[model samples]
Target: MQIIVFIKQTFDTEAKISLDASGKIDAKGIKYITNPYDEFAVEEALRIKERLGTGEVIVVSLGGDNVQEQLRQALAMGADEAILVASGEIKTLDEHIRAVILAAVAKKIGFDLIIGGNMAIDDGSAQVMTRVAERLDLPQVNQVTKLNLEKEKMECWREVDGNREILLTKLPCLVTTQKGINEPRYPSMKGIMQAKKKVIRKIKAAELELDLEQLNGDEVKSVWETIFLPAGRKQGKIIGGEFPATAFELVRILHEEAKVV
Candidate 1:
């Protein structure tokens, strides 16, 4: 089995985000790490490779050169090799075009299985995996929690409506992982050392044979006009006194003060 895991470098969840004058995210001086959910995808891919005791686990990412660090981390976690689709010029492209780039890469490098996060933390866009599947003409299952692979067939359980749903798909399928799939392993000293020596193949968008018009086109269907932090939360008020008096006061506060009666 040749499994490919798609990962991304994103701002740490705990990082404080701010917008620039152009209404874009201000990334200067912000800490970047591998997308948390993608970690689960990497872990699940490595686990599948280990279970089979054969084949390779290749980690792939689409971003600027800065993403090499995240790819190295995936290598330390047991991926055999890595590929990077360097698209620094089109860094702000929409997810539709991003999925096209990924699908092009997937076509260049075939795979038996593809895994990625169900959603990216930064934008929370959960469309990439499905789009890639559509472009590749392969079936996909999302937010998979449990996966069992046997030969060309797979049995898995996924989360839906706060409930679990069992699913089965054949080989050459894509899966987007959610939390609870498996605990990600920390890179040990030896693994880190090994990661430094692994080679990460880098390819430009043009090298993938993508359309130039698509790269420099005004085909965006959605736009982010502006961004700002949420307003500060107001302090809560306490209603004093006992029993009926307190209840009446609460009702009065809701009807008059908060105006939510």
Candidate 2:
């Protein structure tokens, strides 16, 4: 089976991000790393590869030209090779739906199992993998925590508010992973050295031949209606009246003066 792992490059957690005119962050000289959640997806794919013993694993991403750096990190960990949808232009989160275009590209490459992180660190939309699966029109599972290859299907466990959800999905499905699914292994010294020499082919977005018109324009907007912090309360008073009297006074103040119950 051929497995495709999707990875993303994102700014460090503590990055001092500043929005530009288009509401996109300036990435001119920022330090970046693989999306932490996607790393788990990569580790999961590597584990499956080791178990199956013989399968091709490929990592891919759509971003600026430098995105190949992130793909190399995947190669160092265990992926056989990588592809980058390099376009040298920054894309906003909403605009990232262009990944749908990549899905058609991946279809031509022959992938049996597709995996990606739960969300991009910067965007955190947790939407791409599911959309990619939709574009492919194959079965898809999102934010799975436990996954096991069973006799006839893939057993996936996802977290819910009060219980765990289990599902059995057929092959040729895309799975998006959260961090708890698997612990990504650190790259060995040998792997690190090899990564420096690994092959990373650049595939321009235009070459992918996706309909760019279908990839732009979003209607949702965060107006921020108001943007101030909440007000802190003043010091509290220890009342001297009887307990019942104090209770009555407290309720009165809370409702009449504070306008809160």
Candidate 3:
């Protein structure tokens, strides 16, 4: 089994977000980590390879050179190899272009199965894997929580509207991982040391022979006009009194002041 796990580097969940003077996310001082859901995908791929006793788990990502850190992390987690699709001179890449590049990479490097996170934590678009699947014309299952692989096909369970939907797809399919699939394992010291010696192959997006006109086109599926911080939450008011009086006051506040009732 040859598994390819598509990963992304995202802002750390706990990192503070702020906008620059140009009204864009300030990436200057922010910390980055492997997308949490992508970590699950990488771990699942490693597990599948281990279970089969003979297979390769390859982790791939697209971004600037900084993304190599996240790729190294995945490599340390037991992926047999890593590939970095350098964004090159492109400053802003929407999900469509990203998907096209990734799908091209998939074709360049064949795989038995492809996995990725359900959505990136930063943009939360959840479109890349779906678009890749569409471009590749392969069966795809999203938000998979349970997966069982066989010789010719894979059976998986995904949650939709609080209910689990079972799906069976043939080999060479793509799946986006969700929570509750498997706990990601931390990279051991030995794995970390070995990862230092592993060479990550870097491929420029231009080398993929994507349509240059499309790459430089102004048309995009979506655009972010501007971004700003959400309004801060208001402080809570506490009314102290006896039980009935407090309950009565609370109801009055809800009905009148808060107007929630």
Report how far residue 201 has shifted in candidate 2, in Å.
1.5
Q: Kindly provide the TM-score of model 3 when superposed on the true structure, using C-alpha atoms.
A: 0.90
Candidate 1: list runs displaced more than 4 Å. Answer: 235-253
| Candidate 1, run of 10 with poorest lDDT | 214-223
- Which pairs of residues clash in candidate 3, taking residues 3 or more apart in a chain or in different chains? none
lDDT of 3 by residue, 113-151 (tens): 999999999999999999999999999999999999888
Ranking by lDDT: 3, 1, 2
- Clashes (N, CA, C under 3 Å) per candidate: 0, 0, 0
RMSD per prediction, one decimal?
Answer: 2.5, 4.7, 2.6
As for TM-score, the candidate ahead, 1 or 2, is: 1
- Per-residue lDDT tens digits for candidate 1, residues 3-63, read 9999989999898888898877899889999999999999999999889999899899998
- Worst 10-residue lDDT window for candidate 3 reads 212-221
Give the Cα lDDT of each candidate. Answer: 0.89, 0.78, 0.91
Worst 10 residues of 2 by lDDT: 219-228
Q: Which candidate gets the maximum TM-score versus the true structure? A: 1
